[model samples]
Target: MKTFIASSPHVARVNRVDSIMLQVLLALVPGILAMIWFFGWGLLINILLAATFAVAAECTVILARGRSPLPAIADLSAVVTAVLFAISVPPILPWWMTLLGMLFAIVLVKQLYGGMGYNPFNPAMAAYVFLLVSYPVAMTNWLTPTMLAEHHLSFTESLRIILDGSLPQGLSWDAVTSATPLDEMRGKLDRDLTMDEIRQSPLWGAFGGRGWEWIAGWFLLGGLYLLWKRIITWHIPASLLSSLLVCATLFWAIEPQTHPFPAFHLFSGAAILGAFFIATDPVTACTTTRGQIIFGASIGALVYVIRTWGGYPDAIAFSVLLLNIAAPMIDHYTQPRVFGHGGKRG
Candidate 1:
């Protein structure tokens, strides 16, 4: 009779790669629904297009390299990458632009660098920055939550809008497109407007700004769900948010007229999502708890510094990517020592 043997930690667990991916997909539902409700079927179109292209790109690369594509596609990481890419993009982006981003993300950022675990940067953020630089106009066409076309988009119509720049008469993306709250606030600050004056604008809300608080809320809910599912931990998320708050509190205390409040920073573009989903990517983030805290805090600090002083209104992507590059070094210095290890010699 044959017998099976196993290593230590003999307790069994139910977690699998597929299950984790499924949980992540489920967690994104709230945010995806929010996007569709606000931005219309254009969000759906982008998601479908991105998912399709990402799988295709991955398969093509695998085939060309004489490797098995089925396993990779089955793991669902490609789907997650596509979803992240789609969500980060403008809803009304032309289909070719979306395709280009997927190609870059899947082929270059992901596969060419030795596929998922080997890539240095987050594929989604890399594509986002690429699109932003390559097509500023299309990438910046963010639809305002309250502004939708009179006629609701059918699936085909939504596809048409994404594939072609044309929309039905009087159904301009222009009507829906508006500046994000962070961008608006940054613009006002650039114009020498006081923080109080800027906060009094129509864009301002109770905690965050107009049309932004709801989306942020949705992402936050999803993030909490992920945490509950044990797909992620609270260390990184808490550290990231706390660091941002600390920075914001310090700045606001020094000069309230110049710096926006902590609430505004917390509820603005990509803050919640970046803190949870993006920065907590296991492959890219620090593994140990201590390293995670340091990783999250560093990203939060970078986000504050970049958002306030750097050119971009939202620095989540840049901050996360920068910290990802530092994760290895963080882990190296912060890993716990073995029980019998002696103290370091002078």
Candidate 2:
């Protein structure tokens, strides 16, 4: 047996890619369950389809690149990306659209930029924006929550809707679908309705959208679990929520009749989910401590701005993608001082 001297520093691998990705998947479970509970089986079906296709895409792309597919696909990154993308899209989105988004996310966004760590943008969000922009109607065709819904599609029915294009014979689209809470609020406000008047709808919960806010709370639970496990830090989620709250509070204080309360901003849309899960993506978000705060704060502010006045309803995907593009510059400027160095980089 030939025993050779080892390298200078023996680095042990504690958080392997597969392990960390698995933790993320586990953390998403509660939220996924809550989504299915509220939104019906379409959400689950889409997630399954996306995850399967995403894995296949990863294998095909890796083989084409002359790399071993197992090493990449086994890491679960593609699955995570698919899950995130699936959750973001309309539950009953056509099957081909999901496949297209997966291909764009895995082959183009992730692999085209040299895969995983090398990709500057978050593949899930980039694919989401691509789908949202290219097929606006399909992307926005969300189902009313189960509690508010007159009809809830079964698993098989949801599968048929996705694979095919419509509801059953007499089931018109209006029987089940409606505008999202944010969209509803914007439309009403544009008509010059006061927040008090808007709150008259049963769709309004204690603060946020009726069922949607609880889904966000379930996501918050998962995020807190991740924080407890040390899978993610507090800087991003804390700063993101705080900044959004400040903005919402300031605006609401200025015009109580027009602006919604602060809790609305925190619980609405993807605020809680994006704060903990999406914005904390290690590859695309800022790395330094101070940079992370700035990155999260910027995203939160943009969410408020875009949701309030922009064309789109929810702004997580747009805001996250925008900040991801600027993450490198943020890290560069906010780097901490070296141990033995002087003041700061400046």
Q: How well is each residue in 1-346 modelled by candidate 1, as lDDT tens digits?
A: 9999988879766777667888888998998898788677888888998999999999999999999999899889899989988998888789898899999989999898899788888888889988887887788787666542345665676677777766766777555567888888889899999988887767678788765677789999999999988999999999999999999999999999999888999987888988877888878899999999999999999999999999888888888888989999999999898876877766
In model 1, residue pairs whose N, Cα or C atoms come closer than 3 Å (at least 3 residues apart or on different chains), thus clashing, are none
TM-score of 1: 0.92
Q: State which candidate has the highest lDDT.
A: 2
lDDT by residue (tens digit), candidate 2, 1-346: 9998998668888788899899989999998999999899999999999999999998998898888999898899999999999998989999999999999999999999898899888899999999999999889888998998888889988999999986877888988888888989999999999999999998899979888888999999999998998989999999999999999999999999999999998887999989988999999999999999999999999999998989997899999999999999999999988787885566
Cα error, residue 188 of model 1, in Å, equals: 0.8
| Off by more than 4 A, model 1 | 1-13, 147-157, 171-173, 344-346
Q: TM-scores for all candidates?
A: 0.92, 0.96
